[model samples]
Every structure is written in C-alpha cells, then in structure tokens.
Target: PEKRKIISRFGAFHGSTIMGAALSGLPHMHKSFNLPPLPVIFAARPFHYLDGLPGEAEHDYATRLAQELEALILAEGPETIAAMIAEPVMGAGGVLVPPEGYFPKVQAVLRKYDILMLSDEVVCGFGRTGNWFGSQTFGMEPDMLSVAKGLSSGHLPIGGVIISDKVYQCVADEAHKVGVFGHGFTYSGHPVTAAVAAEAIRIYREIDLVSQARRLGDYLHAALADALNDHTLVGEVRGRGFIAGIQIVEDRATRRAFAPELRIGTDVERRCREHGVMIRNMGDVLAICPPYVIAPKEIDYMVDGIRAALDETAAEHLRTGQLA
Candidate 1:
C-alpha cells in the first residue's frame, strides 16, 4: 500500500470528530485521546510575528519555511509521504498569516516530491480572507480542499472536501475495485444543509461579499494596529482581512510571553466577553474573526473592546505586582 502523510501545523483546530482530532496538532485535543494515529506529521507554521527573524524579508521567511518542508520530506522518505495539509491563514493557531511566497514555494516542493497538497480552509473559505478561498489568496492549487464554517455562515452543520480530478478518479476506481465506496456519513449530503449552503453562496455573490470583506478587512486591520500596536502588553498585532491576533507578552523588550499559569490571554478574552465582544484565546494570544458583514462602527467597537480589556488586565497585574 502507498503510504499517506498529512503535514499539519501546531495550533490548528479541524474539529473534534475522531479523525478530526487525530489530524489536529493542538495538544489540548490529544491530551487524553492519544491522537495522530501514526500517520500525521507536524510542521512549522509560518508565523512571522512570533518566529520570523528581524531584518528578514517576508519572501525570505517563506523560502526558508519551504526549505524546511523539503528537509522534512527527505527525512521521512518522499516515497512514503502522501500529502501535506495546511490552512492558508492559520486560525486557531493565533490567526497566523503566511509570509509572501509561502504557499507557492511549498507547492513547488510538494510537486517535486510527488506529494499531495491539502488545504484545510475550514476557517479561511467563503471570504474570510477577502477571497472566495484562502488558497486563492495564497496561490495554492490543492489536490484536496476541506471547507466549512463560513460556507453557510454557521447556518448549518456542513463541511466537505473538494478533490482534484485525479484524486477523485483514483478514489472512484478504488471504489469500483472494492465493490462500494465504503465511506460517507449519514449526513454526508443532507438536503436541508445543501439548500442553505446554496442560498448562502447566492447571497454572497449578490452582495459581493468577497470584495466587501477585503475592504472591511483592510479597515479592521488598520484600526487594530493604530489602536493597540504600542500598548504595554501587546507584543504584536498581526492578521489579514477580518481575522487577526494580538499577542501578549510579559516583557515587550525581551518578547517574553506571560507565564502559561497566569493565563493572561484567557483573562483578556473573559474581559472582552464581558464587554459583549467575544474573542478567542490561544495560549497568550487574543484572536478575533468577526463576520464579514460587520460595519465600520462595529470594527471600532471591537478594537475598543480589546483595548479596554487589555488596559483593565494590565492594571490588575500591576496592582498584584505582576508588573512594575
């Protein structure tokens, strides 16, 4: 049997189904489940703010990450590797946006080694990154595309894969050989969910949601950057379109994160919720992904909420002598 390999990054959240959790790279999902099932390989996520060196151009960072992927394939034996998986803009992993040329370089390397490219666009599809798909934003032509979330804008539980012609044909042939496909959930293609998804896509086109997301995403990024970039506890603010993250640090000069035990990210997230704006906390990073239909005023409200939460958290820490 030809071996299959799925190269995922740390901090990804694909879902909690058995196979989904197994494919996940986040330790929290695997703590008690003993996941990964022996076929998945974790790779370095291209997080410029947290990992890219100062003075390195975005293109250089992308090229280096591609090289690292090539090395990993060789070490694992390219013949045994089947596929590489990724989110164009990492979501649960702190809204990490890839550096310039990242996807193209990775695609080139994967093509060279006969490995399949799988784009897990669960959080990035349907205009989240100002495009129909994040793969479009990053120049990735995946052999398999996984999508959910914004497909129906959370109106239904629907997710599925879009496979390239070659893979689809192979699976079809295998099914014929085996007498049946032998794979598919009872709700694989539920009629109600399909109708809702079709309606969602229709509305998105009628309203030009992609372009709107682009315009609004730009405004949102600028608002957050201007308001929070120089804050005392904000180590970095980075993202694209409607998704972004504000990384918190204990010492800005040293780029040291607060101790995990302190749970600064969780505290700030709680504060944002109290203000009626829900944000996600990934370790010491605070992430936000507002709906594409959000208004300019909503963007301001979101930023203000984050700023107020950060200020309140900082004051609390100072009072406790956690910061001097």
Candidate 2:
C-alpha cells in the first residue's frame, strides 16, 4: 500500500482555505464548513509547558511525543502514510516551539518508515527564526518546504513549495512524460509580487536579517522573561527569534487556564491594542511577533505595554473574582 495519509498536529494552523482548513488542527479552522474527510491525521502537540508530566524533562517529553507519532504511524499502517507536515515553531498554535531533541527524533522515525517531512515555513521562514529557515533553526531536514508571508515581507502576496532533488526528479520525469507539470496558481508568478519578493530578499541580504533576528531575538526573549515571568497570570513566556507567546493562566502551580467564558486571552489582546501594541491571542496565549528591524528601545516599549496590559488584566479580573 502506497502512503496516502499525511500527519499534522493537534494545535497546528496551516491556512484558511478549504484544503488548508482540512490540513489544520485548530478548532476555529475546522469550524462549521463541514469539511469532508481528508487524508490528514493529527499527532500530539509538542507543547512541553502544558502537556509535560510533573517531573518530565524536555528531552524525555520530546521522546514521548516522538513515540506517540510512531504509534500513530503504526496504527495507521506506515505504508499508507505519505508525509507529516509541521511548522518548526508552530505559529497559530500559540507559537508553540518544539521540545529539545524533538525534530531529530521525529526525523529518525520518519526515515525509518519512509515518511517524508513537509515543513510549513510560512511564519518562520526568512529571518523570523534567527536562521534563513525554521528547518535550519530546529535541525529539521524536511523533504519539502512551504514558504510565504516573509517571502515578500508583507509587501506582496506570494508563497511557494520547495521540494528536494529526489522529489523534484520524480516530478520532472512525470512532467516530461505528461508534457506539463499540470499544476499552477493564478498568481503563481505575478511579476509585481515576484519583483517585491526579490527586492525583499535583497534587503534581507543587505541587512543580514538572519543575524539581526538572532541577536535581537535573544534580547527580546530576555526582556519578556524579565517582565512577564513573575506576572500572576503568566504561565510561560516562549518562542524564538522575533516571534513569541505569553501563556496566561489562573493557577501557575498547576498550569491551569482561565475559564473559557472569561476570554482572558481576548481581554489581553484588547488591552494590548489599547496600549498601542498589537498582539493576537490564542485562547489565553498572547502572541507577539514584532518586526525584525525593531530596536532594543522599541522592544522595551513593547514589553512595557504588555506589562501594563497584564497588570491591568490581573487587577480587574481579581476585583471581579473572574480569576484566582
């Protein structure tokens, strides 16, 4: 049996289109369209903070998740599983970064089962992850890469897939026999978008965006830790490069979340907006992915805004007995 089913994760977010929705595991992404059965299966999310055992270490947690994936593949029948798609630093999935030794172990499993690794680099491509690509950042040697967003640096809409030489050779041979590739998009190679993407690449090269993101990301992460680590509502502050997530919780000891009805994440998002710093919330996890060119002082300002917003959220929720 040739592999057909693809594996995703529980908290993943691929896109908003029908195909993308089917590939995604986010609740909102799967809502109400009554999507038909697709070949996608979900594995455990690699969130150590929320899912880790009381005494489990990061490396062990990674191994456990990898084992779970292996079990999932076995149950599905390895030959019937084609590929597993992943985001190196899961973005819409609350910016969930993988655990230590995660990708290497997962890659080992995939190699053993002849399963291809498809990396979704839409959010972590370019300089966002401190390396040229998220795959590089996390030691993932994916067989394919899907890239967008940073490609044109938000200057234009463009995205593309990159396959390895082995896959490309197969595709080329098929195209030669069929006399065409038989796949395309309306704006597959729009001149304007291509030009913008090209120029964006040039700018990234000129400024050494990768190194900048790496250094600045370290500073940003430190600032966030210093500011929010002790906050009553913050359970964790996590991410890499310029991207980050601040997980808000009711009980830090138990890593408990605020009640859904409280909409704490939405409230934090609203407060951040009011403070003039934009952020999005996934349940109670507030995401902050600032521009790569941001300065230290600007980072301070952003962190301060979040601090003010969090403090206010804590005060109001406490007063109303909405949070403990």
**Number of the top candidate by TM-score?**
2
The whole-model lDDT of each prediction reads: 0.87, 0.92
* Candidate 2 per-residue lDDT over residues 1-324, each given as its tens digit: 477899999989899888789889888777788898889999999999989998999999999999999999999999999999999999988899999999999999999999999999999999898999999989999999999999999988899999999989989999999999999988889999999999999999999999999999999999999999999999999998889999999999998888899898888888988988998888978998888878999999999999999999999999988877
Q: What are the clashing pairs of model 1?
A: none
Worst ten in a row by lDDT for model 1: 33-42
Off by over 4 Å in 2: none
Q: How accurate is candidate 2 locally (lDDT)?
A: 0.92
Cα deviation at 151, candidate 1, in Å, is 1.5
> What global local distance difference test value does model 1 have?
0.87
Error of 1 at 193 (Å): 1.0
Backbone clashes in candidate 1 total 0
Per-model clash counts, in order, read 0, 0
